[model samples]
Target: MASINQLTFIKPKQFEWHEVPAPTLQNDGEAIVKPLAVTRCDLDLYMASGMYPMQGPFAFGHEIAGEVVEVGDGVKGFAPGDRVIVPFQINCGACDNCRRGFTNACTSVEPFAAYGFAPTGERKWGGGLSDLVNVPFADAMLVKIPDAVSITGAAAISDNAGDGYRTVAEPLKQRPGADILIVAGLAQSVGLFSVQAARALGAGRIVYRDYDAGRLAKAKALGAEVIETQYSPDLRATEEFPIVVEAAGLPDALTFAIRSTQPCGICSGVSAGMSNQAKVPLRSMYMKGITYTIGRVHARTEIDHLLDCAHCGTINPDDVITRSVPFSQAADAMMDPDIKIVFERD
Candidate 1:
């Protein structure tokens, strides 16, 4: 049996390359893929640093852009050598939830069956950091990378970019050219991606708020009006917006996001590591008739649209990728404080 090296998380702030059995197509719907570019998700950094509680000894990547090396007999949409984007979550694509565009809550697989992390169910789907990965439901799970998009730049589209897309896509559709407010501080990629996504989606006047000078600079470079500020739980937003996004995973940031939404406006939170017990201003929400949405992203549903944007050169992932390194430097890149990093293989 052929084996490949996989990046595995051993403990907080620790990871190693380990040899693991390479995967093959188990059924006609499955396909074998070789990851070419993998980007770090904000959750990866949090989990690796012990900021987020997650057990390790699990394979370590989820966001990836890869090439199909082999396809099962039933696989029709893809063939060997096709460059593709693989969504983080596993879904059968034919299930009720998936058909309804809720791929995040796919009914065909055990709840939360995802790549790049520990097994949540009986099956262990390997992470994207491996030399090769097995993708079940190939036709349903894979989206070919656009010819106009850079393979390395599109890597984060697997998760973070899609997550960022959802922040502004629907809201902008509801109110085209509306100005948006994004509260970003902790993580760098998602918020920056949101700014670009909003621009592509026809949003007007993107205002990004964060205390990190580095992130603010990145936001400004990405065409967002940057606001520098500190986080406080009691913080109140002085400006109002029809669309608000909270990317900073802090209770204070969430509160500020809600306060910033105008009456009948919508707020989406892409933050992780927020306390479950955080309070919402129900009275204000009811009086203002505002809607707040927060949860895991249905990444598969938005891939094509984001790719379309990428195709037209409206949003370039390279703008947000602060660092790009060869695969051998994965360990060192993961520990560094760079805003966004991409690990690529030749």
Candidate 2:
């Protein structure tokens, strides 16, 4: 066991890293991956801050670009030394939900069963941030990282990048030259990924709103007309968008997207049910004829499409990754409040 299974948690802001037993393959279809680079999602940061409803000291992360260390007899597609991505959710490929392309809601596993999220009785898997993490249904769940894309670039593909790809690319694929408005708050990387994905799909006039000046600058660099706005319901009063995405994962941000969308426009959200009372403007949404979508990402189902863009350099995830650090200093990096943080192994 390399470094054992390390546990890192936020008491709510402070984090601790220590040794636990490394995970092992429990099933014939399972594989053990030693994560080479583990990335943090904004959700992790939010949970760390103790704002959400879940209790912690659970596995600390869910995103990674890692190397396969061991594989069970039933696993045929991957072997030791193969670099792969472990998506946050676990889906059995043969299930009805997975066959229909909804792995996030797969009937074979407990609802929202992923490596992250505080371990409830229904789900309990070690996070990928540790040395050796188990991946069940490995042949179906794991997606290989393209050689052209760096480990840092591929880090978020399991969830953030793939979700952002679906969020922007699928909607705008037919609407050539359509304009986009992105309201980004807590979902720092996905927000930026949407910009890149939208640009790759031939979007026009992407206008991004975020409070972080650094993030706004990164968005600007990615060809979006960026604005730094404080967190409020009134992010804007008049700007109507054809395609609007609220990757920030805030109810207020969703409301802001709803409030600003044009009639019959699509307003997609990156999060669902983070707040007890989100207070939607149902009347306004109905009047405007909005189409909205929010929830878990079907990462395994969508990885191929995104990888095509990545292979040709159509989307640049590396540009948005603001900081890279040694895995040992991950606690410091997590506390630094970077927009996107990728941790490398020794």
Candidate 3:
């Protein structure tokens, strides 16, 4: 077995790399991938800080783009040496949910499968933060990276960009040209992607609320009107947007999203923390006729279109990548507040 090194969270605020056996092709539909580039999901930070409860010693990454090194006998439309982006959610393409285009809630894998999160025991595949990873249901889970798209640029599409697009674009289709309110953070990629996706979806106006000046500035640079606020007392006082996205991954942001949206508007969230106890103004939502949906992204649903937008220069996803670090420095890079880090294997 080839030895693969992976970063694991030993305890709160601590991380270390450990050597383990590289994954082997366990099924006829699986493929072994050596990730070319990887980026931290915003959720990983929560798991690391003990804000989210997770079993210890699990592999710790989700977003990845890589080269396929091995393909199972039943794998089709892919081969060794093919460059591809792995969707963070695992799904069996033939299920009812998959057939209906709800791959994020696939029945084959537990509620959340991809990386970092504990497996549903249906598939042995872990997160993508290693030298090698086995991707089951390869035909449904992998998207071939376009030759025109750089590996680094394609990396975020596996999760962050895809989540952002799905969260913003999918719902906005029901109500186009509505004002969009985004609750996001500087360290979080989902917020940044929300801003870009909202703009791409042709929202009448994009208003963002965040405490980080850098995040606000970045949002502004991407054509969003940003407001810096503490989100205290009532976040609704800051702005009233017709459509809202809670990408902040905090309870407060969720509250803000429900309160700030206009009556009959849509609110979509990708905040992982919502799984825990979170207070939502149910009475307000009921009275206002507000619609809410939150969870893991159905990446395949939006990645190809998002990639097309990125390739055409209409939306530059690379603008959100604040820094790139060698894979060996993954832990330190995550701790760095200076920039959002993208880790690449050297």
Q: Compare candidates 1 and 3 on TM-score and give the better one.
A: 1
Candidate 2 residue-wise lDDT, 232-313, digit = tens = 7666556898799888777677788888788898888887736766777889989889888776678878787888999899
lDDT for predicted candidate 1 compared with the true structure: 0.89
By TM-score, is 1 or 2 better?
1
Task: Tell me the tens digit of each residue's lDDT in model 3 across 120-154.
Answer: 66555656668888888889888898777878878
Q: Candidates' TM-scores?
A: 0.97, 0.94, 0.93
In order, what lDDT does every prediction score? 0.89, 0.81, 0.79
Distance (Å) between predicted and true CA of 5, model 1?
Answer: 0.5
Summarize candidate 1's per-residue lDDT along 97-183 as a digit string, tens digits. 999999999998898889988888888898888899999999999999888888877788888988899999999989999999999
**Candidate 1 lDDT for residue 196:** 92
Q: How well does candidate 1 score on lDDT at residue 112?
A: 89
Better of 2 and 3 by lDDT: 2
The most accurate candidate by lDDT is 1
Off by over 4 Å in 3: 235-239, 272-275
